[model samples]
Target: MERLQGKPFPAGYNPEVEHVAFTREPLYFAHRLLIFYVVVKCAQLMGHGFLLLAGHRRYVTPTHNLTYWHRPCQQEEGSIKQPPLLFFHGISPGIWFYIPFLTRLGRGREIILLEVPHIVTQLSFEAPDRIETVQSLAEIFALHSISKCAVAGHSFGSIIAGWAATAFPQHVKQLVLIDPVCLLLCLPDVAVNFLYRSPPTNLFHRTLKDFIDPSSEITVSHALRRHFWWYQNICWLQDVSCPLVVALSSEDDIVPSTAIHYYVQRHYRMQEAVKHEKEDDAGEMTDQSNASGSGRLIYWRGIGHGQMLVSLKAQDRLIAAICKQAVESGLATRAEDIKNSGQKNLRRSRVTAA
Candidate 1:
């Protein structure tokens, strides 16, 4: 058997070597060794299969489950009106991990936490399928009258959110991407290899094997293939029209700040034009300007990919910005509609006067 050793990589110092193979030893106790290996391997496979099944079933909110906790918005009075902010949790772990952030945001907005399909119950897969699954969930929300709301996603969830916004442009008025996985244009090969090597399960190569398994690989690939599609999806962001708010963490190990900055600057422009347009129309169009100020990009200095949503302060800031942006976008969109109506009225008035 070959021993795995630690090595320094771009993301961090990992103790495991990349692509090391293990073999069953042959000796006086060959029969015992074979039995032990088979037992261990079977256990690993069973565990992975169980997780895969659970993850697939729990990925989305069940349509039949009716109980959902609700809290009135802090910004509103007895009016009881709050913009829905759809949230997507990151990989591994589970949505319950975000209770801190969710509790904070729940104080003001009706948060729809869309769990990534099969993340907890099944093996991870490629990015495209994950995107498709999220898009389907977004459509479900729209079918239930969840139109013109702010959509937020973190890490891998961010990629899903981006696809959701792009796929259903009318449903998502604004987007809040927190330390997104796909925004990074280029990642070091070492980092990508490190991510793949870790492979959720450390006891055996179960997670890795399941992910590569042809029978169950599609969903697993969509969930685990983040590094491969990072650049491809970032490039695809150029086609998204809805205003975006990208909150990046400088201390993220999984994704570098340089990559986030590049995509935000290159593709979305960090709301510079929108802000400028708002400022330009400030005097003549106060409501319109306020609405145009919806798009924003925020950079948090010392937060990691996982810690960004765990912090109370971070959650507060994120929720506040998202709520404000949603309101502003709605106001702006409505103002434009009204402006068009006024233009039509003026045209009629002119014809009548003439």
Candidate 2:
């Protein structure tokens, strides 16, 4: 993995990812090897079928280290040219868990899915650290000529997506972070590590714990906590100029709801302060109504960290919020008009049937 040359990383930053160098006794090694094989097979079976149906295309960068999957819209050039949506999945084997949401979200626009380099690499080696991964993702975006997009991330992916907005604010029109972990104030590093490795309480987390590469997950989790722990890293959101929506689950076990609330409150308060400052100066705020640069926070009840992606109610809420933001920011046109038009058509059909 190549470090971002000509640019300095942040203080105390490590350029490369470090893996656990535990000596593998034959029996233990074989056991782990078999488990890994089963995990990979399960991921392939569940995820590949959806990708085939969606016509998903995976491309390896000319440099080979950076690769991503693209699922183009089946029908483009609609009445409105909506901005494309890019997804960063949580800590799962792949984006297989999100295929349902991605398929639905890709209705009229293209969808791009990014895999963690370490997880996707065929070689028996770890990939770059968080910072390099972010840079690599930006490289992919630029390579594809995607100047503006709606970037969304879930769980671990949220941190990457957030950094993407901060790193390439010029290119991101909107950012949606769902069930983000370790972005806000949280327990100590020891507690975080313990909870991450603890037994899963549900099927979703169980799948994540089992399928994801353990060495990579542990490495990234600790590195991210060290690098991006609330005050040190997430506070950078204060500098993110794009419109942001943070969705939180009140019953989340991995990330405390209090931390999420703290982040949302603090961010909006700061935005409000900025708005007030602009008002006092009698200067017009920049794109005040644009969804590309606003902060909106929402809380959902009963949804856990994993359920948010699969729950229909949760998904509907997220989709509605996105639509509302897009309509308000003028990213999606004729939404209301189209809905009303569709309603009229439905009513006519019912009457004719009667």
Candidate 3:
């Protein structure tokens, strides 16, 4: 009997035979087709299972006016002074998908997971209260006594991170963005057109149903309903002033690299504005004085959008840089210093507006 790749088969099934058997051929074909179908079905089932799990609530925090669910970080004992890292998840299979990565990062540190409303619900894209959602989150943090923390967001979540940093700069000391969706840069016309023309209903039903399962109709509708929030996120990024560390995946297909570069350039130019405004004001410092230039753009070669979370090597390097900056900023002052700085900044902003 001949073997296929060293696995022995029955004598009649050998490929070296002069003639193929009629009865055996049909059986072989059927077996191959069955294997293929089963593999495909398993893959589909797995995808749907992930989507459903992503929608499940992991942590719930309630205040007087709002209620939200977030993934809680796994904390180690005796780590009181550990800095808090807030993670804002992306648009796909919810934060649950990144549990392994988050669990690793959360060890010996404080981590807060922020959940965008309607993420897995049927109203995902119809975020009429988008701004209020973020504001409420900020208030939640304040109520929870999170004075200053590192804010990190992935993809669509980056928009939220950027907005939070700008709206409440005092609270967010470090900003980390991964494969951010910079809508301002030159986007492929087809992609942009697709985003503009496709209603959330059609998009949710088509893409989610095809990739996930037809039975995931409710989940699909919920994710699609939040499409408007994605649009608002673009505007939020433009006005962000916090020191930012952006990681761009070299192989990202959903977000173009050009857009990322454009956003960095725009923010760099804003840094220049800070420099110009301070020219010889004596009390004012150089452009480098602000932590914004601590701003960095890191490119991860061969990493796809989703893989960045799971890549141990990539996460190590990225997290190290982010934590280093956070520590430096944190050490520069005690708790009182942070409070005073916040008060001074508030007064300065009001004066400027007047």
Candidate 4:
């Protein structure tokens, strides 16, 4: 915590994201009761059933490295072409809450859901390091025979989706980050909102604390306190090489959305300037980006953290962005060919490994 809390936002920091006297006092509220987890487990069963009906097959990687859900395209007509979508879930009650969101993305395209048990599924103290987790991603890619894919993640899941882009650049073509907590992590907003700062005592606050309180979930607490290295979690604009679709909520309490917008705008300017200089020097226009150079930056006017899962408009927007990136990458055109090529696609099973 002390290492993260430094003075005077580096040489140049976006004024919007400037740190605001961040302080810490862990476990302000106790974890939820065991009955709450029991309720969550029941909800997971419901979600599992819904997924089966939706044609999502479950698979576990070698040595149980990861548990994921894969849903192939049901409709292959028309000129629709895209690559598979690899997605990660953030801390929530269970997967069932997200089936509505995930099912929409599954329309006319293949989608894969990466599960994060530490966040929402169950109580566990184990949180893998970056190296081990990235290796697990490699295993996931090889198992599915995916040469390239578009990765979309929400909340803390964005951190892992980012890993695929940075660790295996050749494999990831586009990124769709929805209300990501990983960006601008150097700032104190995320730590304060998610961990340190306490909400006011009230009827709504009482309900809110049940979920966001660091000590409310043992696994989440451990992940935040024992693991969660910001250096490993933090992802900047320059770190990725793929076309990025960053969806920032208007009212995100965890991260500084306004600050991130300014920071990204600055980077966009830098990116355009660098491109222009290279073109001028080479005396040829090559891989020319937009002159305005504002990359696909979507700012949700009223959405808050994880609110897109419930809003129909937000879902459609996310689908369109994902499809656009997938088409641009042209990696999914080969998806059908790969499916026909007879790779060991996951077998449909009712009972999946947890």
**Winner by TM-score:** 4
Q: Each candidate's TM vs. the true structure?
A: 0.57, 0.71, 0.61, 0.80
Clashing pairs in 2: 243-292, 243-293, 243-294
**Location of the lowest summed lDDT over 10 successive residues in candidate 1:** 21-30
lDDT of 4 by residue, 262-300 (tens): 887787778789778877898664443432233567788
Candidate 2 structure quality by residue, lDDT tens digits, 39-75: 7667866686768667878776554475568866555
Off by over 4 Å in 2: 1-36, 75-80, 117-125, 185-235, 288-293, 335-354
Clashes of each: 18, 3, 8, 2
- Cα lDDT tens digits for candidate 3, 197-251: 3334686565553444311333333343323434455634445556678788788
Write down the RMSD of candidate 1 (Cα, Å): 12.6
Query: Candidate order by TM-score, highest to lowest?
Result: 4, 2, 3, 1
lDDT of each: 0.55, 0.65, 0.58, 0.74
Index of the highest-lDDT prediction: 4
Write down the TM-score for model 2.
0.71
Task: Indicate the residue-level lDDT of 147 in model 1.
Answer: 63
- Model 1, which residues run further than 4 Å from truth? 1-80, 121-135, 186-222, 225-236, 266-294, 331-354
Candidate scoring better on TM-score of 1 and 3: 3
Number of the candidate with higher TM-score, 3 or 4: 4
